[model samples]
Target: MVDLSQYLPILLFLGVALVLSSAFVFLPMIAARFTGAHKPTAEKLTEYECGFPAFEDSRSQFDVRFYLVAILFIIFDLEAAFLYPWAVSVFKLGWLAWGSMMVFIAELALGLVYAWKKGALEWE
Candidate 1:
């Protein structure tokens, strides 16, 4: 049986990481409080421009198609990312890995086809 004490090093490492990360996040805020400027002016508060007055709010609604396309790009990008590593190590991997990858590719292809059929790929 494995001893609970065997995880002491990992626990210590996690504790140290937590402390360091907390310091990294909070130290900057503390330093800013001590040294940063707190002055506010109408010019600084206004939206920046190339000498053009603002016509609309910065927070604007986007079409659903924009998010759909973005998600599709991310999905395909991740697929290629995983494919490259697997392709490099293909010779060492067994038939099971090849079969699994084939299934993954097939599922992605089906999703792409579905998206295409639904006009999700079309830009208005």
Candidate 2:
């Protein structure tokens, strides 16, 4: 039977983390109190983009193609991310995992072809 009380190292680690976080917050507050350099200017207050004055309203309409591509990218990227874990555990999971990943990739490829045919991938 393992003694649960032997977890003193974990308790010490938690205590160190708490102390470090508290110090981080406390030091910043103390420094801000002494530093009289806090000032708001027109340049600082205004939203600057690419070193140019923003000409149009930030809340402008975006193209649907942009959103479609973004969604497709996120979906496929997440699928690829999952593939990494499946690949590492392939020995344990056997041929089923490989087939499953292949199906997933095929679906993504089909989606990409469909998007291309529908002009969803075209920027112009």
TM-score for all models, in order of appearance: 0.68, 0.62
Mind sharing the TM-score for model 2?
0.62
What lDDT tens digits, residue by residue, belong to model 1 across residues 1-124? Answer: 7789989999999999999999999998788677865456798777676577667875888899999999999999999999999999887998989999999999999999999999999997
How many residue pairs clash per model? 0, 0
Ten-residue stretch with the least lDDT total in model 1: 32-41
Q: Which candidate is the best by lDDT?
A: 1
Of the candidates shown, which would achieve the greatest TM-score relative to the real structure? Answer: 1
Off by over 4 Å in 2: 1-39
lDDT of 2 by residue, 1-124 (tens): 9898889999999999999999998988778768965566887877565877677997999988889989999988898799889988988998988898898889988988999899997886
If candidate 2 were superposed on the true structure by all CA atoms, what would the RMSD be? 6.4
> Global CA lDDT of candidate 2, please?
0.87
